[model samples]
Target: MNKRLYLELENCIGCRSCLAACTQCGGHDERNRNYVYDVNPLVNTQTMPLMCLHCVNPACARSCPAQAIQIHETGAVLSALVEKCIGCQNCTIACPYGIPKFDTEQNLMYKCDLCIDRSKDGIPPMCASVCPTNTLQWLTDEEIERKQKQFNVKNDKWVTSIHLENETNVRVNLPGILQGITKLY
Candidate 1:
């Protein structure tokens, strides 16, 4: 029932467009540190856009002393209120990916709010909307689970990402590349 942001690690061009687009959202105002990049846990070399995972059981919300973090009706976990946020960084410490940020000037915790206004109205978030390679998608819970299962990593913790365009997910597996970091060609 929940919608999630899905990523394709291979499609990332390292363009930083997602980061640029993030600033266009409401309340960003050159201060919100929203979009962030993260490396895959399974593959050290692979990078992906990192945001609030909107966990079913969110540690950030529970740890917020002010209880400023809110869960949108659509299941999106939003950024903490600047007025209510104490800049304690408790959520930052609690987050598995370390995605939360502190704005020293504003003295508030900043994290991706998932473009709450657009998402509720059925529009994709800025990052996903501007992804030229279709590497990011907004998908329902069932769609994400089904796609992830296709990777056959249900037991191995391999995450499914991107447009599902190319079946090949990792580049290091090729025999020639295994010999060295250089391209096989």
Candidate 2:
């Protein structure tokens, strides 16, 4: 198992704390993973977070000319190596999931390293740590199995019936989790 971040898209409230937490300005870790993005889920008044799938066969690593990208043994894909990265954006272009970003001012590329510094000590990533609704999570083996069994939504399509304060009914379609996902009904 790759053992990366897993998101329960239905629970996300679009707070952008995950996005903010990914950035240094949010005041968590100094170096920015800066990978999370928000996208429409074909529904009104809602969005879902997206990030690197950190593929078993990563296009970013294969496409790097500078050989800056490295996949850790724990399956976390690190951001571009500062000394080796030429800021070519090859990884960005080559990524099937479009996870990488080039920083113009810094002249380097950045992506989620799964918070390697923190996770090494068994800490969850800042995004997961800060999520208010537990929308985003990192699952253990037992948790993964439990979620997989409890939730019926597959990777292809996502739906969660929600009723608003005004009793407005909305039907939403989630694209899928970036990596592994499980949810509680």
The runs of at least 3 residues in candidate 1 whose Cα sits more than 4 Å from the true structure, single-residue gaps closed, are 31-46, 149-185
Instruction: Estimate every model's Cα lDDT from 0 to 1.
Output: 0.64, 0.64
Q: Write down the worst ten-residue block by lDDT for model 2.
A: 162-171
Model 2 scores a TM of 0.73
Which segments of candidate 2 are over 4 A away from where they belong?
Answer: 1-3, 25-43, 152-185
TM-score of each: 0.73, 0.73
Q: How do the residues 95-168 of candidate 2 rate in per-residue lDDT, one tens digit apiece?
A: 76667888898888888876777765567777778888876776675665566545555523332222111110
Error of 2 at 61 (Å): 0.8
Give the per-residue lDDT digits (tens) of candidate 1, residues 1-185. 24566665556556677888888887677544445465654666545566666664567887899998887877677788877898888988887657778778878777877788888776787888888765677777666667656544432344322122112111111222222334311
Clashes of each: 4, 0
